[model samples]
Structures are given as structure tokens and as C-alpha cells.
Target: MFSMDDFYKSGEVEEDGWNLMSSGGRSNHGWRSQSSVCWVGATALCLGLLLLTVIMVAHNTSAINQWDSKYTDLIHVLTKGRDELRDERDQLKIQSSNLTQELEALRSQYNDVVDSRDKLQEDIKNLHRNRTDKSCKPGWLKFNNKCYFVSPCGTSKTWEGARKDCQQKGADLVIITTRDEMDFVKSSFAITWIGLSRHEHEDKWKWVDGTFLDGDGFWQDGEPNNSDGEEDCVELSRSATAWNDVHCNQKFSWVCED
Candidate 1:
């Protein structure tokens, strides 16, 4: 350790010894040390900034990945919900179709039942009508389920007048609906007007009750020819085979059914 004054006093020093006398060299060395320190500080600052940038990028990437995962999960959930709703809608449509078919079948069955009931009622009415009973009034002949009265001799009247009189007596003109009925009426009467008649404009004969005659009816041969086009009333001819058509306005005895 030499003193500063001693180093300055020495003119030339060895190569390994420091030159403390030249102020320029000392200043140059000091400047080089300071520059190295500044360079190291700058490099550290740059490295710190780079590291901060890396951390920030990593954080943002993590946030973005989390958000993407959540979005994927939401999409899956929504798609599943939509599928379930579609399936439910399909099931409801199937149920509605089945119900419609069942309703149609029920309606068809109901119609069948109604038709059967109507037919049964008609059969019952016919059966009741044909049953025999003893509910005939005086001066009336009982036959099967009905009773009949014969107009006295010379009590002839037009077909319309005969029907009106029968109505007044709580009765109607005799309607020979069956073969047996026609035969009985023919045997019981000499010649009389019956309940069957039709208008000149009609093509067929109809009973007083508004029912049409079923068959050709017991018409006399070549009878009902409407010879005068005015013969619309029916009568049991005295000498003819079964029945004949005559003028409705003609006067004749008639039978009544009660």
C-alpha cells in the first residue's frame, strides 16, 4: 500500500502496478465500470418487463379457456333440452292421434246401438199391435186385436162422408192389411168402401193412416184401370173377384175399425 503522494512522485512504474499518476487513465476505468453497471440494470429491467408480459398472457389464456369450456357445456345442455322437448311433442301428437281413433270407434259403436234400439222398438210395437184382447165396444165385432162396425143398410155415403162419420164414432175406415183381413171383410160384407184410397195425382194407393199398400193388393182382374181417370176410391165389388176402384164421390156403405 503506497501513499498517493509516493505514487505521484514515481515517474515510471512496473507493468503489474497501477498508474495512479495519470488522471486520464483512472477516469477512463471509472467510466467503463459505470457503463457496465448501467448495462446490467437495463438488461434486468428488460427481463422483468418480458416476464410480466408472459404472466399476463398466461392469465388471459387461462380465462379464455375457462370461458370456452363453459360455452361448450351450455351448448350441450341447450341441445339436450331441445331434443327432450321434441320427443315430448312427438309423444303428445301420438297420444292425440290415438284418442281421435278411439273417439271415432266409440261414435261408430254408439250409432250401431242406436240403430239396434230403434229396430227393437219397431219390433215391439208390431208385436203389441198383433196381440189379441177383449177390449171391444158394443155392436162391434172382435177380430184378433181389433173391433169393426158395419154401416146399416141404406146408410150409404160418399167415401169422404164415410170417413168423417167413422172419425166421429172414435173409429176409422177398415184397413185390410193382411190376406186374412181382406178375406174376412169380403165374406162379411156384400159390397162396401174400404179404408184404402188415393188421389188422382198419385200413382199408388195409400191407406187412411198414410201408409201405402204393400203388394198389388186384392184388385179385381183388370180393375183399377182408372177407366174414367176419376176412380180413386177402393171398394169390395158385389160380383167381382176381390176389390175394385170406384169414384170417391159415389155413395156406398162402409166398415169402420175401432
Candidate 2:
């Protein structure tokens, strides 16, 4: 709507060398100038907002990358720890196996030592028997390098009392081990107390000298039915190579040996 005539109103010039314009023209000019200033200010504000958005995006991307890096490091550390634990477990298993092998070796050595000790004991026993082969007293009979005495008939006593009497004579109740010894004792002293007995609740018989009976004892067939659950002492029978279990408190003649 503006024209050149508006700046040169009525083709006249003012006295101060300024252009004279009509009131309508001046108002239009001021409105155009204000519109241009507002447009430039709006464009500047849009550019500033765009730059701020880009800055925020860049900051967020950097933070995300940092977080990812930290997570990766944590995972690596956890994996390393797991591997170390696995190695440690394997070592413990190896140590356990080694310990088991050592224990087996020690047990083998212990068995060998036990065998050696038993042989030594047998040698010592043979040496002692050799030294005392001919050292029997008048009333004692010598057999197998040991002296034995049969209590006189009708000299019956309880098993405990018999052991006490033998102890007073520096001897103990006779221990019949071999079949020959059994035969000798059975022929010499029939129905006599021997050294075999057991505790009330025990099934194994031990001699009065604290030696356990070896192998099957010379028990009479079906004789030890533990009659009345009271028989715990062993007695030699008159029959050949047979023995019987009797009540410990029963009185009977006993054989003594040293």
C-alpha cells in the first residue's frame, strides 16, 4: 500500500531539509519498522532453541557411553572372580585327593609295622620258652616249657576262688590252646575249671591271664546253650577234647599253670 508519494508528500520539502510525510504514511512506516525488528528477534530465538537442544543431546549421549563403560568393567570383574573361584575349587579337590592317598599309604605302613611287631613277639616268646624248658618244680609237671598243677580231687572251688588260689601259688588258671594241650589236660584232670570265661554281656571268651581264645574253643557240642543264661565259665570234660560252659559260681577242681 505504500508509494513514493508518501515519503515526498505533495512533492514538498520541509525547511530543516527533512522529508514531509502525511500522518497516514508516517504511521505505516513505523508499523513496518516494528514488524522487521520483531521478525529478526523471533528468528534469533528459534536458532538459540535449536542450538540448546543439540547441546542437551550431546550431553546425554556422553553420559550413556560412560554408564555403558562402567557396566562392561563390572561384568569383566565378575567374570574374573568366577574364574578365580573355579580355580580355587579345583585346587581344593586336588588337595583332598592327595590327602586321601597319603592316608592310604599311612594305613599300609601301619599294617606292615603290626606284622613286624607280631613276629618280634613270637621270637621273644620262643626265646623265653627255651630258657625255661627244664625249670619245673617238684609238684608241677612240665609241658611245652610251662609248669602245670592239678588241684587234688574234692578240692573244688568257685571259678573266682580257684583263680585266687592259683594266684597265691604264683600261677593262674590253665589256658588250653592247642588240641594236644586239651588232650593232656583232659586226660590228667577231668571235669576241671580252665581259664576261659567272658563278661556277662560279652560273647567272646578270654582267659584269666587277659588273653582271648584263638579259633573255635573245645566247646562240647550244644553244651554252652548258656543254660539258664548263667553259665560263663569254661570247664574241661572227661571226654576226649570236649569242654563245657558252667556257671562261674559253681565249685570244681581247677588246673593251674605258670
Best model per TM-score: 1
Error of 1 at 124 (Å): 4.7
Q: Candidate 2: deviation at residue 201, Å?
A: 2.0
Error of 2 at 240 (Å): 4.8
TM-scores of the candidates in the order shown: 0.53, 0.50
Clash pairs detected, candidate 2: none
Q: Which 10 successive residues of model 2 have the least lDDT summed?
A: 11-20
For residue 167, model 1's alpha carbon misses the true position, in angstroms, by 1.1
lDDT value for model 1 = 0.86
At residue 223, give the lDDT of candidate 1.
Answer: 82
**102, model 1: CA deviation in Å?**
10
Error of 2 at 178 (Å): 0.6
> Whole-model Cα lDDT per candidate?
0.86, 0.86
Deviation from native of the Cα of residue 223 in model 2, angstroms: 3.1
